[model samples]
Target: MAKLTDEEMMKMMESADNAVTGEGPATMAESNDGIAPLTVRKLMIIGCGDGGCNIATAIARKIPDETFVIAYNTSKRNVNEIVCDMKVYVTSDADEKIVDGSGKSRAYSKDAFKLNAYKNLLETVNIGLEKMPDISYIIVCTTTDGGTGSGSSPMVAKLLSDNIDVPVLLMGVYPSMDEDAIAQYNALEWQSEVERIGVPYFVLDNNQHGMEKPKVHAAVNNQGAMIASLLAGREFGNSSISIIDNRNLYMLLVQMGGRLVAAIDDARPSSGQTLDDYVMAMLQKNYQPEPSNVKGIGVFIKGSRELLDKMDTSIPEVQKKYGNAVLRFAHIENSDSVEIAVLLTGCSEAAPRLLEMKNRYDDIVHAQKEAASVIGDVMSGMKNLLGDPRSSKRRGEAKEPDISALDL
Candidate 1:
């Protein structure tokens, strides 16, 4: 049997869509009800500065023809230069609110670029939407802890949701204890905010994910690569085998992305598999990995004994398929169920920016906490100086207190 060429696959996709819509199939060769089969027409990667830029670049590199609109707050820096031919819109006019992702300023800490940044960001999105009417996915990769990525991403998600109806997949990075209070606070707030917006978020922890280098561009490249693969019917970690498993993972991302997209557009979604079912389906799909590609698999088992026992049954098969790919196991004390997250890094060069960011995450977090504390102290002092209720006196009864009148 001859494998389907790119053109054939596309034709099949068109046929599948026709079948699902009851318009008759385009080609009998390609018709499936799976959400992954739904073709992605356009994607806009908002907030591409710091690590977010790398994520955007990865997607840009993967799909040269796909229209990618990058929204960055740093203008003079020209982060767009990193993203090859994709269109870029930098919010140089947005206010100096904490620009998340590496705890950096969205405006390069310049007063000229401060104020109206949020509105500028929204405008960028509007332009992108207008330009790419067929956009099916909007992936916002920002730092949960830093300034621009942290602050702008949620706003973009909200504005986009309010205007267009499409899936918004937010990939946010969380800083470690090293990032300090402000960075941590910003990250937490953004995550909570995006969650409140009811968007499916994929969060990566800087502390947990080990990287080999440290550089903004490098880090994003690594993360961006993961995002591209995960979106294009590829699996992460240990679960990339069995065509069914790959399709299952691909469907999970598409379903999640589609759910948000549908909600944003105010369109009703056809009920499909629950999150639990999706995970289980992926787990059940055999790990018949390509032997040559297999290097090592890291197993993270965190659940009830029953779940562990079930996984125990499947370990041998996984080992047999990947030539001892199992690497490590992490036990979560109170997990209710099992989750097998996979990462396949087939001898590729380690992303340097990622390592730099990971190494500095804790330090940056600490600095942010100190900054927050200092601000809090300053505000408290100002409050005390301006008005102390206990020391207050009636306006007419009190004489004007003069600093010059006091003895030096």
Candidate 2:
């Protein structure tokens, strides 16, 4: 066989550069013009916990039909609730015994997914993915506050990064400050492991937009969907305008790999809200430090076709404000209300909120330890108060029937 010429080589490579296209059996096919436009990278998303499953399923519901979405967890209940393209359940631990859920204990969660259980998850995920030949990227979604997702997601991501020759990104949902200390500390632990692995990631602070469970979950889901659109919405969004096609998303995610990228949506902007207001709010709420370190920004705006024409001017305002950042836009017309999503890449990873959470976690642990010294055990409180008949008490009381055992 004769070797191809430089022209042929260049043409083949220039067809789709870098980590944009998925390398599957159908990754390449012939078309009349030449090679088919495999330039549009395919995205494969896996949601790892209840919060993760909900967000992934919610995104699948809105984006263009046929977008690959999978929800996985140890809980049958969570797996049952998810309605998506695929559902994967870990079932039970390595020994093949069925288990219900992690019950909020990350340690127990990690253990429960051991041996056979772990292999089952890996095999199941691969089996589902094997059918899709053109998988360009893999996104792992999970909640940092819970037991199942929190314990298993980092391990899953790290393992997948090792096993599969694909770039893996993580979307972590951090619990609200008002949540229990278990959740708060769990969130921090998840952060530490994710960072150690060095996969680029972004987080959504629960209760940042609302306090109620449904409201918080909805806000998180919507925000995640907006980011998904940024990466893959070109299929759904009208392509005539500044559409964020596969190449654009490839640039935002893969080419600029290993940076904190956030695409937050602020919907139904009031008539009074300016572009600056929306951008600033999106940045702050998403835990981005400031726009200074942000190397790239992709904006998606949707509105009435007539009104969107006027909003075109708002697109350029981002560069004017951030200076030096690369800017792009994806415009979708015919929405009932105006909504804007701003995607930022290369922002500072040391978000102030993370530090605040760390300090809060430390304070909480310290406070609990301090309280432990003075706070009597609830079960033994009455027994201590009543004094023991067989033993001497700290208060110099005679040993009575130590009602503590009796008290309990």
Candidate 3:
């Protein structure tokens, strides 16, 4: 395709602006130059549990026509409550005979998926495909600390990755330590399974969000929706400054075992703030203790040409800081204000948290084994003291006189 000129780009943005303000159609009409207008990419959002469903619902609400959303859970009630294009209730024979929660058992959830959920998923995918035949991406959302979400997510992601032609993205929410020990264990196990499945995933740490349960849920959903919007939104402009298409996004995000982080700066430029200073400040506010193992960086800037020019100079500093990591850039002209979105891909700093959870899980298992051993020893001692009636009878040493004297 030919590069777009600055004037053309500005017109496209104006069209988008008009669309957003409801003054005109959201999509641009075909230009006289024979250039087709930008269209939102179709997405399939498969939510695995309550958390996933919540995020999916938020995304659906924001981009109802662009996405097909579905929720799957072992709990019929939970699945019933989610608002989505479809709901898939996963169940096993045991679940059908005696309905109960997975009791936070990752094993139970995995079994349910292996025995029953996969079929439902296939059917759901068929229906979704009928609605959105041109779907370009699949996003699997789940919390990695619960039975239904943690256990089934990896399997679901793997199935989609293997069967579908499009790239699959995993949006995983890590559990807070305060939730439950089982949750920690589940997260640890789920991480290993996800790694083995080898799908790219984004982690949202519930512990670090610093919100109450309800607020955290909303925050997470909003963040997920924002990321989805960024990926799906058009990055084209008239100028050949930089653009991130769906392929660019997929390449940046599909690095196996990489954690994704996005930082956004929406504040007005202060009197003394340079574009570089603003970008650095945004990074500081969003990224905690810089990741040393960074592998890729994507920078999206929406600002005036002057600010973008300033950003051009700062790119070298970013490259220097990240060392040899790959970098991608996109610039969109917006006269109202400047904004930056930074996406980083690398080995996550969540290793320490995972290790801690693993250690705690090991400690619990050890303690349980020790307790069982102690209880077994005490029971054995009591049995020895009482003597074995069967052994006594076999040895012809059984006694029968003591009860007769008292009864008659």
Candidate 4:
């Protein structure tokens, strides 16, 4: 398909915005039922790489129709393959083509984003916001190992945060340890950039899930989508004693130090099972180091009113375990079963893999420096023996070997 010019793209987006706001000739469809139309706050999911696109596609499938989904990449193949509401390719100038089949060159990817990709992204997001004035959240999804995703996502997040009014949530996928050194290095670099950006983010460790290489991507994508859906306060239609609306979700996510991790347990209550037991189990099973120094905690309970009341009382005890972390509660009523979902923010334990990756990257750099020094010494010795102008060797000294006489 022919690429749309910038002017054409802008016109198309403006037209869509007009249609959405009842200012254009096009009209919105009527609701099927006699019930009033439900007004939902819109969410924009922007995926930055192959892994990110996978997660965004999964999320688009699960989120409400009002949610906007777009995927961005420098690779034409990846852009063509991903399923999203929009696909954006960050093409380079004719003189500078940036293509790495392995997706390992982060420097090139960063250049691509800075040169023109970010502008395109910002423009597209502005158009989306115009169409859906209720869009209060922007979720930026990317993997912290590949070239385009890792190199550009942090900058994109920062750009969105600085230019847009909404809260930008970063969903970073951590690469497995067994991946190549370049990926590890890229992950470390990307983490540093994200830390500098100082936005709220959640880390999904691909290695911890115990899935095989071939299946892990899909698993990661599905899990991320599920968490995002829940956080967006979408109703599951089960009985609810209390509701956590989208505004409440926005408040929880917009807190300072937005490093977050979550866990969910859905099981019938046993004789010995307690709310404390569920909370402890989630902390131990889902997160590393138990996430100390938390600033906010969100607990969503699905059970009977009695069970919900018990959990509500247990919140104080849970807060005590985390240096008096502030708490938010959501309850749903369901008989014969209990479900717990935990979202912990401002946790240092959120991105332990980033620390490991940084250490690994340092070691790799040290090794490379040592190797380069040895090569430099060897080259100096060769130059000395060859009698360079600075070496001052006598004519009688042995000369360097000449292989020109050897037969092919």
C-alpha local distance difference test of each model: 0.46, 0.64, 0.67, 0.68
TM-score of each: 0.47, 0.70, 0.73, 0.73
User: Against the hidden true structure, what lDDT does model 4 obtain?
Assistant: 0.68
Q: Could you list the CA RMSD of all candidates, in the order they appear?
A: 16.6, 8.9, 8.8, 11.9
Task: Please write out the lDDT profile of model 2 over residues 34-66, one tens digit for every residue.
Answer: 543233455677888788888788777766343
Candidate 1, residue 343: Cα displacement in angstroms equals: 11
Misplaced by over 4 Å in model 2 are 1-42, 91-95, 234-242, 259-274, 281-292, 302-339, 374-408
Candidate 3 local lDDT, 328-380, one digit each (tens)? 43434545455567666654555776776777777777888999899788787
Worst 10 residues of 2 by lDDT: 18-27
Candidate 3 has what TM-score?
0.73
TM-score of 1: 0.47
Clashes of 3: 2
